[model samples]
Target: MKIVNVVKPAIRILPMISKDEFPRMSIEDVQNNYFWGELINNQEGMYNFRKIGMNAPKDSLVLFQFDNIIIASAELLDIEKFVIPKDGKYYGAYRFDINSVKIFEPITLAEINKIDSNITAFSQVKQEINSLFMVEIQDLIKSKQMPILPDELPRQYYGKRTEGAKRQIVVNAYERNYKARQACIEHYGCRCVVCGFDFAKFYGPEFEGKIHVHHVKPLSEINESYEVDPINDLRPVCPNCHLALHSKIDGKVYDIDELKSKIKRLINN
Candidate 1:
C-alpha cells in the first residue's frame, strides 16, 4: 500500500471554572462534578447536556454536559494541570487545560439515554466512559452566561487517515511492532522524531498535510513475513525527513538515525 498522509479532527470544550467554586479540586474531582448546561450553535440550534466524566488508564478526556448537549470537553494529554490564576477576570475562577472547543448540533434525550445505557453496560465491564455530564439549563441561564456555542468551542484535528485505514494501520503495527511507535511518540512528546517541531500551529489539517507515520525498518527488510507491529516500526515524521530517511541505494535502506543526525547538524549549522 502506498504511504498516505492522514489527519483526524476531534472536538473538545474547555470550561473556565471559577476558582472559588473549585478552589482545591483535582481533575478527578472536577470530572465527577455533575455540571451541565446548553451549548448553542448558530447553525445547529441548541444541543442539550448529558453526562460528564473522564477516560481512564489515562484520565485524558474530561467532559461536561447540558442535557444531551456536550457544552464543554477537553483532552487531558496536552493539558498542563495547574491551579486557577489569582486574577478574577474570568467567569469560573478555576481553569482546566484545553486545546480548543466546538459546539455540535443539539443531542436528544433519547440519544443521551442510549449513551447512558451504553456507558452503564461498558462500566460493568470496566470500560471507559466518553459521554457528557448533564447540567440544568436553569442554572446556566441563572449564571447569566450565554449558552456555550459550537463556534466558540475549540477544534482538534483527529488525523487525515480514514477510520478504516487508521484501524488497519494501528492493528497492523501493534501486531508486528508491539507498541514501539507509541512509546517513541510519547518519549518524543509526539513531535516529529527527526525535525523536533512541537508548535501547535503545525497541528490540524495543515500539520497533517505535511506529516506521516513511517516504518523505520521497512517491512521488506524484515526477515519474517509476519504482520507489522505499530509500536516497533511506526514513527511520526515530517515529509522531508521521511523522504531523506527512505532514500536508498542498491536496495539497502538508508540509515535513519544517520539521516536524522545530519539533518540536526544542518539545522544547527
Candidate 2:
C-alpha cells in the first residue's frame, strides 16, 4: 500500500552511518550516550561545503542505514555551516540537525530478498544509498500494526557527517557559543588577521559585516568549561583565511601568527 503523506520526503534514505562510528564505544554504548541531541558534521557534503544541509529537508523522514539495513528513522531539523579544526577532505563543512529518532529492527538482505527479487543482492541495494521506495520504508520501519519486534524507545537523535559520511554527536561548547560575537567584532574590527583583507574595502559596504569570526583557542582545549574574553579569544577573518587558520595540514596547527608570516613570505617572493 502506498502510504501517502501530505509532505513526501524531499529525499528518502541516506546511508549516513556504518560500523565505523564512535570508535571507542559499542553501538549500544553510543546509543545511550551520544545518539540523541548529537551533531553530525562533514566538509565534503558539497564542493561549496555550506550546502550540505540541503540534502535533507525539514520535517521530512530520513532513514539512517547501516550494513545495508535500516537502523533508525530521523526527522530532519536544522542545517548550518560548521567549522572544525582538522586536516582532511572534510575540514570545515555543514551538518544536518536531526531529532525524534526511532530505531527499527535490523532489516537484512535475506529479509529484503524475501520481499523482492530485483533487489536480491545486499551490495546492489545498499549501493543505491538513498534509493528507498515508499513500500521499502513501510517494511523496514514496521512490519504491521505491531512495532518492529522489541520496540526501542525513540530518542532525540542528532547527526553530523563528514568525510565519507559518519554520524557524530553534538557536544556543547556552551561558553564559546554564548559569548557576545558582535562585541568581539566591534573591538577587533572586521578584517582578516592574517592578510588584513577587509570586505568593506574590497566588496563595498554591502559586505561590511561579512567576515567570519575565528576562535583563537580551540573549543576542544577549553577543558569542559570556559570564561571567554571575546576580544582576546576571537579574531575576525576572511572566509579563506578562517579556513586556513583551522587547517591542520600535516597534523599541525597552522596558527594565526604562522599564517601571517607565510603571507609576508609570499609578498616578499
On TM-score, the leading prediction is: 2
Cα displacement (angstroms), candidate 1, residue 85, comes to 59
Please state the error at residue 97 of candidate 2 in Å.
7.8
Which regions of candidate 1 deviate over 4 angstroms?
A: 1-189, 203-210, 249-252
lDDT for model 1: 0.37
Each model's C-alpha lDDT? 0.37, 0.50
Q: Per-residue alpha-carbon lDDT of model 1 for 1-269, expressed as tens digits?
A: 99987432222332333354457754322322322211211211122211232223222343344323344443333322224422433212112222222223433334444534544321112133332433332223234333321111111122221111111210132112213434445544456678775435566643332334566665444534454444655676765666666666567655668777877788899
Question: How well does candidate 2 match the true structure, expressed as C-alpha RMSD?
Answer: 19.1
- lDDT for model 2 comes to 0.50
Instruction: Show model 2 residue runs off by greater than 4 Å.
Output: 1-59, 62-179
TM-score, cand. 2 vs. native = 0.41
